[model samples]
Target: MLLMPENKDQLVSVLTYHVVSGKVNAADVVKLESADTVQGEQLMIKTTDGDVMVNNAKVVMTDVEASNGVIHVIDTVLLPE
Candidate 1:
C-alpha cells in the first residue's frame, strides 16, 4: 500500500480509518456519531452545509473499498493526540 514514500503518513491515517467498522457507506457514516480509530483516538463525525467531516477534516471522497476495509479520503491528515 506504500506505493509512494510521500504518502506514508496519509496512508496510515487512511488505514486507521478503515478498521473502526466494516465497509460503511457515506450515508452510514453520517448516521454514526463517532468512531475510534486504530490510532486510539476518537474521530468526531459532523455534517455542516452538507459536507461531512471527520474531526476537523472534510471527507473529500468516500466509500473506496479495500480488501481489509473501506477508505474515505479526507482533506487533512489525522494524527492521534
Candidate 2:
C-alpha cells in the first residue's frame, strides 16, 4: 500500500522501512532479489533499464556513509503493512 504517514509513530515506521541492514552498495544491491528492512519487512529489489528499485521506490543514490550505517536514497516513501 502507498502510505502517507499521518503522525510521528507512523512516520518513523515509514522511514525505517526504507532502511536495510549492512552496507550493501549499488553493485551488491542489484545482485539480491530481496532484502530485510530494519522495520521487519522484506523489500523486493529489481533492476530495469539500469536502475535499481526497492519495492516501488527507486534507489537514486547509494553508498552514503553514516555514523550508524550506510544510506541509499530512494525516490518514494516506503512503509510496512
Candidate 3:
C-alpha cells in the first residue's frame, strides 16, 4: 500500500517491517524461520533451495552495511494486513 506522509503511524509500521532491530546477515537470516521487526510483526523467512525468501519477497541482496543495522534488499515490498 502507498503510504503518504500524512499517514505517519502506518508509514512507520511499513518501514519497520522492512527492518530488524540489529544487524542480521545472510547466514544468520538463513538459520531462522522468522525475524521480529520493529513494528512488532514476525517476518517469515526461509531458504528455497538456497535462495532466501522473506514473506512473499525474494531477498535479492544481503549484508548491506549501515551504522545502525544491515539491509536485505527484497524484490517486492512486504505489506502487513
Candidate 4:
C-alpha cells in the first residue's frame, strides 16, 4: 500500500489533486466523465444513482462562489496513485 503524505510538498500534491483547473459548476460536473487537476493528474469522474463521484469522493455541495473560482465540496479526500 502507498503511504500517506508526510511533507509539505506531498500535502500540496494531495490537496491539488482535489481541484480541477477551472470553475466548474455542479451542472457541468455531472456531465463530465473525468477532469484534470492542477497537480498534473487526471481525476476519474462518475455519476451513479444521480450522485456525482470524483474518484472515490462524493460531491456533496457545489457552486460555492469565490473571487477567483468556484468550490465544490466533497465527502472524502482524493489521493493520487
Off by over 4 Å in 4: 1-6
Instruction: Report, for every candidate in turn, its global Cα lDDT versus the true structure.
Output: 0.79, 0.84, 0.87, 0.85
Per-residue CA lDDT of model 2 for 1-81, tens digit only, reads 325444767777777887788888888988999999888889999999999998898988988988987788889877689
Instruction: Tell me the tens digit of each residue's lDDT in model 1 across 59-81.
Output: 99988888887788889866665
In model 4, state the lDDT of residue 32. 91
Model 3 root-mean-square deviation: 1.6
Q: Least lDDT summed over 10 consecutive residues: which range in candidate 4?
A: 1-10
Clashes of each: 0, 0, 0, 0
Model 3 quality (TM-score): 0.89
- Candidate number of the best lDDT: 3
Please state the error at residue 4 of candidate 3 in Å. 3.9
TM-score quality measure for candidate 4: 0.85
Q: List the residue pairs that clash in candidate 2.
A: none
| Model 1 residue 38 distance off true place after TM-score fit, in angstroms | 1.9
**Per-residue lDDT tens digits of candidate 4, residues 2-36?**
35545777888888887777789889988999899
TM-score of each prediction: 0.71, 0.80, 0.89, 0.85
> Which ten contiguous residues of candidate 2 have the minimum total lDDT?
1-10
Instruction: Give per-residue lDDT, candidate 3, residue 72.
Output: 85
Q: Give the lDDT ranking, best first.
A: 3, 4, 2, 1
